[model samples]
Target: MKTLLRTLLIPALALITLGAIYFLSAFLGMIIPVGPEKEEYPKEVEIFVHTNGLHADFVLPTTHEVHDWKDVLEGKHFGEFETPYLSIGWGEKNFYLNTPTMADLTAPTLVKALFLPSTSAMHVDYMYGKPREGDHASSIWISEQMYLELVDYILGTFELEDGKAILIDHDGYYDYDQFYRAKGKYHAFWTCNNWTNRGLKKIGLRNSLWTPMDWGVFYYLEK
Candidate 1:
């Protein structure tokens, strides 16, 4: 009786404690400001930030005056998806590869994702057309320099070998997408949504001061 009670009580208390810390940190982090005091550069590139209500992705044009991703995100690497825009997202390796949907998530996977700083992967989805502004998507325009800065930050995240992204041999959630090994570890402090926010911050765009949630990143976007 005592052993059983201890086991249950300890995990329950730990969960409660972690939950409190997460929310409290998020609230404070979002409030604290980062980035330029004002956006002065002319908006030259239009990009999309997309969320499935949970994870966020940085959606950029496949080919643009600023940069061309044709050779990098080649169609031959994945199924044909030579669309106008490509959506890139980062997440824990096990979670991204194993859990295709929320329903597929398991207790061990969730626990490992939140607490463990494990391997990460980049999920690239090629879009057929420009995403219309809707509940799940939002568009923002930034300067050419800012866009280039974003390019550097994002492209740098990939675990490139021989000056190229190492393709992972796995099917995407959709036929038009593929996965690549990425730099960095996914854990409590830096999540997929947080990666979007960080990129926005790097480009002097509007973003949450800090966020682990997708909604927070979109919520702080320019109205």
Candidate 2:
């Protein structure tokens, strides 16, 4: 009995210690800024960064002067709806489809997601209008050039074949929301929030050096 108990305690303690170190590293990475974002450009286009306390999502107007997302994604998948904005979020495929609520997340599934690099998917949600400034949401004004850069980056993330993104047909929470196959692997270092962070960085937005949580992306924007 003593031997078995000792064996269990060692690994349990190790896991706890590792978890603490990871969280500490993430906290530090989030606080450190890459550099000041380009403020010289006129803030003409409005883009939004949204979080649900756990995940970060990018919200943009469905049609911009330079690009139209409806041209890329099949409008029919989102059903017939008159929406001015669309929300996009990328994350692990299994986790995204299986774990709608945190309560549904299982230990084995989480371990696989964090340790093993796996398939990724993008969630596209049609929005009726722009979100107001409030908890879990914030807006950023950027130039047309920067917005185009961001748009290109987003389009590249899609797994295109025959010049179109493949949709993952599945039963989900809303008729207005759907998932599509994406071009990246999901892992601990490259989290969903990191995808949003990298997109901001690519568009010359002030962002964290590295972040694993949604709050990191919001830290600079909130301030």
**Can you write out model 2's per-residue Cα lDDT over 1-223, one digit (the tens) per residue?**
9999999999999999999999999999999997675468888899999886778999999988888887788857445767889889999999889888898999988987899999999988888989887888999998999999998898889987776778888766577888899988999999999999999999888999999899899988888
Error of 1 at 31 (Å): 2.6
Off by over 4 Å in 2: 77-79
lDDT of 1 by residue, 1-223 (tens): 9999999999999989989998999988886777655657787899999987778998999888979876566446334434788899998989999888999999999989999998999998888877778888898888888889999999899988776778898988876788999999999899998998999998877667889988778776745
Write down the lDDT of every candidate, Cα atoms only.
Answer: 0.85, 0.88
Error of 1 at 50 (Å): 0.5
The lDDT of model 2 is 0.88
lDDT of 2 at 108: 81
- Name the lDDT value of residue 124 in candidate 1: 89
TM-score, predicted candidate 1 vs. hidden true structure: 0.92
Please count the clashing residue pairs in each candidate, in the order shown. Answer: 0, 0
TM-score of every model versus the real structure: 0.92, 0.95
